[model samples]
Target: MASPLRRHAKLWIPLAFIAAAAVAVWFVAVPAESDGDPDYRDPTLPVAERVADLLDRMTIEEKAGQMTQVAVDAVQGDAVAERGIGSLLNGGSDALHDTPEDWAAMIDGRQEQALDTRLGIPLIYGLDAVHGNASLPGATIFPHNIGLGAAGDPDLTERAAQITAAETRVAGVHWTFSPCLCVVRDSRWGRTYESFGEDPELVSQMATAVTGYQGEDLSADTSVLATAKHYVGDGGTAYGTSETEDYLLDQGVAELSEAELRRLHLAPFEAAVDAGVGSVMVSYSSNDLGDGPIKAHADSYLITDVLKGELGFDGIVLSDWQGVDQISLDYAESVRTAINAGIDMVMVPFEYERFIDTLLDEVEAGHIGTDRIDDAVDRILTKKFELGLFEDPYADTGNADLVGSPEHRAVAREAAAASQVLLQNDGDLLPLTGEESLYIAGSGADALGRQLGGWSGAWQGTVEGVGEGTTVLEGIQEAAPGADVEFSEDASAPVVDRDVGIVVVAEDPYAEGVGDAGAGDHDMRLSGVDAAAVDTVCGAMDCAVIVLSGRPIEIGADRLDAIDALVAAWLPGSEGTGVADPLFGVTPYTGTLPVTWPARVSDEPVNVGDPDYDPLFAYGSGIQT
Candidate 1:
């Protein structure tokens, strides 16, 4: 028999080797940490490893809290630290503003409370900077997406996003709910202006906005996370399906075959993912892919199989505001279904505690698997780590001066010029001499609020003091220094008594869930006053009608014949001078129609590739002098 010492050595040597191998595996999964103590706080480690370590340290409640996003107003009474809320969002319209400096203070206070939490996770704040840093007081409001779509210049589009990102960071926001990638197939859809037009290819090209938002290094001081929103198809909703009271196409059903859906709706998201978009907000609308109307917020095939498994989007999947609540009658089951469907973050804008409790209880009951919870938290925490919020959680207050700077306004002007589409110019009426006595009159002419459209200073973009910006009349006057310029909100004014008449008509400001044209039933006709304004003004003078709207409306042959020129100036935002730049020989007319100009509202759903492809002005139609 062997000696006792020899027998003990053999057993101890194998045990030591096993322990060493396990340690090696841990290091490989995580990045190298200092002193080999498995420290997640080590800055030198890869983000994945740090995320893994932090995730492992979190309890179920902490992890669930990291998945919850609430409105800032709801964060009352120790909620930020006590509840471990992961993020905060100021909706399209929020009651939070004292000054630019106050915005920073508000953000920093919440951040301090977040840092005081058990795990010290920072809260990411999001807002709708759709145009510029739109909701902010001094930030430049770039042209709405429809204008950019008509401009069709990806470079200009990207530049607009870059300015938006820089200005948003200056205002203490970490994310922007912008670059609405919904390919608008129907102009009647209330949210048509939010899209990049009805082409998958165009939307895909514009997805470069992600690069401008996050920059090459996501952790850069000015970088804000880009969101590819209304995932799947919010734009393709079948008309008349909206359940919203007094709302139409905003959240209607998307009725398309899987092939059609894949071809059109999913194209931009693929590009967005390729461009490294950090988040995708699931649509509130439903989709019927040859089966039945199923909400995208809880569709396992849409959220999990297609978005995650097939496309390989590793970013967090966020739900729209109160989106999960609408998925099912039983709120608890809605939480379970959305989680299992691969939503990593819940935008329970209100009632966040209920959302957290339901998710926590669901996980404990085995209704939501532990693996799912881990995956959800993994994505959310990974983004926070990538954002470098751990190393620097406070607002970079120095950037505050960047808001609405002259340089940024110059960029917005460039976009506004590039986005100006010349839809009609009969008798070479454009390239305005500026030498001609010009009469400018219309409801939208002098109204900056109407020019900027919705999501400006307030939710619906009320026309009252819609932030600082030059009005269209002011811009035209600047362009036509040689010509006598006049402005009148009343179209019936004697402005037609001039060498050339310029009439501006506009759709009233509207936003999501409210602007729908009531199912497919559209009155392609312009609003009564505006239409009469066109006839009253154009019928008298050699006038050029500038339709300042989100999308095309009915301008019948009779109406069309009344004007010597027509320009589709889709919601030109704050840079009104950019519109003048192209009109008065300062810049050439280069933009083309993004959407088909229908002859009548009866041509309810006309598009480029439709079977009967007749349009008042074909897609890509633009006339230059």
Candidate 2:
């Protein structure tokens, strides 16, 4: 219809415009090799290859920085990006006011700075989140490991860890120092509740938490690194041998033969390794295997030859808080020995700058080899790569809503209910029909902090109660709304002739070496205030005593004979309703005693298999109602 040249020009012009737009979209969408991106930045490559590429380009200063972990309060502005801090942690009480979103914002800001560094490598953040994302106030707080050990349900342990991982990731945290696999041999070690039980088999069974935290893949959005903590023999530390002042057993020595160590203590860690745990934290306590006691941080034979070589744990080996300093008074020697002992990361919580400079100097001198530094950096970076930090380092702000959700609390309630161990129920006193006139007495009746014990909101949980939690009294009232419910803190009120009196006694919250009992007035006996309340309530009416404590406390033989019912409510945490569920027949009493209930304060180290194993209640004893 038209001239040949004009018609052909018209078709070619439209086609050329279309081709130009398509080319522009392709360049913007796809990351071509010619875009000058490094192999480490490529998401398509294997994580090992990416780690290798990244490690090859890092400087010695950067490598040392990769092995240094600083506490959150110690970090100054721009220090994270400038010094290339490999990790950051929220040590208890450091940043206690941070909400879930606040934590996410802070972590994301730090991650942004880390990404702005020369290599643009992202940093990882960690927390003590031993029981749920407990550092955050509103996050779900599950029962302590002792309760879980009593529950004896691996599936429940796994579910608790899974929820912990999700909430932690939502807050932009990458790692949790959790699933304390210490098979506690001594109940007076202060961290007794952190252990699963006295038996290696029970502790090993709880190792399913590893699978829960990491999930099937590390790169998943909900996954966070899980640590099998205080590696080898923390719980077996001998009483009165502690280096920490006033601590009777914590940070003491585990004096035992190598065979006994393996048989009693090493089995849980071995199981953790088999579960593919991404990290192992060395204990602050020392181990005596036919030789003088040596700090685990300086024990090359155990960490390197045993944990790495024999156990085949390729994950990063981390030092506990100021753990290396305990090895030697000489800082340089301490650094040298700890590094030589195979500690991949140093938790130089406060003195990060000193640690970084000292580490670099050690590498410059012949004290610590560059190859070892490289190895440490490699292990650290491998985890960062596996965490998918390079591709998506920012927190999923949308997931912040998952913290303390109703669904999570439901699971925690279930775990708490399952963990209730009914020690005595004379004349079928328990499974109360929710129709009794209940008279609740004692400090633990309405105190959430006492029920949570240590590591609830702060390192050593507060007496004023740290986070949101329903108290046992409130749960009792909720369970029986139509019944007459009265609460008295000290039972100083006039005696009421109720159908039943519920007396709640508690051990005040303590963490680490501070909670140690068995030395001078710190014995495991019930506190005077709680005992007085117990006497007043049990004397006036038919009573059921609920002992809310971290470990077994001495309730004298007279008290045991007097009470109609006794329940071991070991740190039920935020979900106090679970404690009521079993009592009101909502759930059955399935939990057994994780540790033996001692007959007296003299039975300090009593356990399942002692030659003189006389206990008030044997290990695994629970009265089914």
Candidate 3:
């Protein structure tokens, strides 16, 4: 009934009010300034002045405390306050107690003590949330790096990092050691599956994108801090040279020339630095330049002279666990060398008192300059400030419910679906929708403990009661609700006259160099036990074989020809159920081979850059429905 002009005026008034209200809410929720000037300007303020302003309020002991990171096992809430410890880490050997609430409570208690320190500096918590929020009980676990490489979508990799950040925050963790940028050149290395691929371009693309997952601006977010790790040439190490008593372990020497090193090992790190990665962890392997292992904690040429000066990286440089000790047998000497080398933090997970005492002695003797100590402290403090720890000093236990929540699990399922490579499905045995009963065989089929793979409940992974984990047997039951799943340790176990037979074969559960050592000199052939088992199973029933291993193994042509389908499910973590998504028709398989699949051990260690390049399955090759 009103005139057109009057009607327009009435509509515009409410819309203007709504917009004004929205702006007001944002400003109120996120305050512009707390205790200081909103637009603080101090061009003349050296990094030390800015650091000293914060440190002046801190007690001497509290200042000393900021230099160390203790393992979670060694902590008690009151001890953190008493010693003024600056950081805590859940090493690969540690695990969260059953519930997310329990995990959060543990972190919250430590934070409370850190806040109670004289200066009230917040404590930084770190963990190896390498593939997902892996340490917590119910946290969603993604496929290892190899699977991620096959997807070849940087945007998706970034999204995965975002999801990892969100879920990790919910579990009371504020940092993740992830996005391993190592360009793996040999399949014989134990941690090959942890790398994205053999090419520097692919590794760089995936690793750089992950920096976005933790948020481009760390100053105002609760998202986890990301670390680009095992810096420089860990993946190019020669076979049988790792430091482990076992010949095949992880800490080995890389054999590349200096030029080859820059082309392959250095590119990903350059990209990571450009992406504003918060930290870098040094590798344990020695470089080919005769520098011994680049002992990140004491290599001035690599850490200070190159990374900081040449590359222009400004983030904190942390030592891998126990790496500082490699500098000198005398604890005090080790402390001096590592600090002089420009390491901002020492992850002396144990023996902290010794390190602290030795460092104090070095400072008094003038072996390590106070200025150098102050420089390292400033770097550490600047990072903590940038992370907004001063404003919010405690973990939010209420958010613990988000760990392993349905949303996170869904992401893992999506990753697994995307990562499953259909190497050979000759008779269309996969997507087995109509099979009445699925006869499942092999040690891994019923082994929940082994299915989770390394770094789950232990450093090298465990075989017995390795905490609560899911098995592929359970995954199959969930996938094909009506089909019967039979399990067998001995591959020749009597079949129940099933319509389809599935044999899940695995290398006896081992991690890193231990797994590599067992495969000795062979051209990727299946072990005698595994081969005998596969033959026994196939001879007993009509079946398909699914390999659950760290890398591809060559099976005899006669043995491979007997199978109707073959799938490479490389250590698909707690969400084994996700693997079945491809086996069933729920999701199409799209993953390609991230590493070359050699036909035999004699044809070992070939990478994409090699001239001949003959392989059982070429890099980037996959099958899709």
Candidate 4:
């Protein structure tokens, strides 16, 4: 029983050891990092070499532990260190977060626990950060992916991602679950805004966000690992097939032919891999390969064969939250299936204790192989080495002040302005010149929560405890200083006499399964207060209906005729000024429809190229001037 150092001390290359020590001393001056473990600590060696050295030293327990990720609240005291946990994730809108300093402190506290382990291996912290670090207050809330798709400028998408990376790193987070590569085939899916568009080509183009996230080198302090999510065919799930009670289709069953899956759903992932994305998240949905409904979590052929073998994705493959649990009837079997299926890391979230025990039991029973564990941990460790997380494990708080800086918001505004699609301009009523008074009406007119959509400060995004940002009403006032712009929640205000009326309406914000349209039972239309407000405003004055929604709503032919102009402002986010820019002619309307605008809710899953295509507004349709 000799110490590993004493045993391998004779094998250590003296020159390489000296170079590693030099690297440790050199990198420590800027951001404090690892100074121990000669072979792993040495920055001069190839990442592969460093990873191999570290792997040989880990015990079976530690190796198994490296693949588990749990929520921040799941661990207490020194338990995380005791168990040798490898990663921590702060879920959307965690109440513990108050300020950047507090966030950084939490990360440091966990990291300290992680460092106290036998090998002092550091943990990688992650967040949703899908749109400009949504979990943090004062962080820039960029337009959702559907809007970015409408803008169709990969350069802008990359720039926004770069800013997201910098801001996220400042908050001490090193990984972002973003650039949701789901190519939406159905607009009824609640997460439509999360996708670039219905077209695979469009989704592939926007994978530029991967470049923005990883930058040229992940070793840089500013870069964060980007994730291409819901692998294979999350976006192609057939309507009405969802089993998550009351839900329909989202994360349900995808029955796409292998060719269609590769051509459409899998195309964007290829672009992401080309950009060197550090991770891929397996989809919660099931894909039927002629046998029966098989969850992606248990699909060895897809995860290990298609993604890892065929696509050549060398990065880590992560599981969605609680995804493994749904794989089989028993937790231990589920754990075994998901692991052997090629998921490198399991986002166990709240049940890490159970997950850890299950995995250990599976390994001990020979249900799961040590070779598989080694492979998974190797990929995980390789990324950590590449991220330079071992070199600098602590949060970089220097750019904390840049969370919602003017420069980042400026880019958000530009993105918002470019995403607006003017569907109709019957009387050229838009571009209000400030020469005439205007009236603002509808639910979303002043709702910052609605404009930002889902996954903003919380998972099921809401107005309650929202971050600081401009509402559409505020943007209107700012855009036309000389003109009289008044807002009435229900258009019941005294001054009904106005040159023009702007009615804004939205679907209450939603995220994933909870936002589904159960067999089209969920009406994608402006109803109740929203519809009444639309009528009141259009009745009082020549009106332009500014639709702030994730996808096309059922504003039937009657409603369309009532308004003089129509603009599809798909969840423009915090910068209401971006919407105002196009509405007031500050910037011309350049956005085209990313998905086909349906004429009714019954045309639920309609998109471009459907036979007998009769959309209210076709994909790529937009009015100029």
Instruction: Name the best candidate (by lDDT).
Output: 2
Root mean square deviation (Cα) for candidate 2: 10.0
- Candidate 2 local accuracy as lDDT? 0.87
Better structure of 3 and 4 per lDDT = 4
- Point out where model 1 deviates above 4 Å: 1-38, 93-95, 241-248, 495-497, 519-524
Q: Encode model 1's per-residue lDDT on 504-576: one tens digit a residue.
A: 8877788876667753333445777777778877877898888888889888798898889888888888878
User: How well does candidate 1 match the true structure, expressed as C-alpha RMSD?
Assistant: 8.4
User: Model 3, stretches more than 4 Å misplaced?
Assistant: 1-52, 56-62, 75-79, 216-222, 241-249, 290-294, 464-470, 482-485, 495-497, 518-530, 540-542
lDDT of 1 at 99: 51
Pairs of residues at least 3 apart in sequence or in different chains that clash in candidate 2: none
lDDT of 4: 0.86
Q: Mark the regions of model 4 whose C-alpha exceeds 4 Å error after superposition.
A: 1-37, 241-247, 519-522
Using Cα atoms with residue i matched to residue i, what is each candidate's TM-score against the true structure? Answer: 0.92, 0.93, 0.85, 0.92
lDDT-better candidate, 2 vs 3: 2
How big is the positional error of residue 92 in model 3, measured in Å on the Cα after superposition? 1.1
* lDDT for position 434 in model 3: 35
Ranking by lDDT: 2, 4, 1, 3
Per candidate, the number of residue pairs that clash is 1, 0, 8, 0
Q: Clashing pairs in model 3?
A: 248-513, 249-513, 286-293, 522-601, 523-600, 523-601, 523-602, 524-601
Q: What is the lDDT of residue 17 in candidate 2?
A: 93
TM-score of 3: 0.85
Ranking of candidates on TM-score, top first? 2, 4, 1, 3
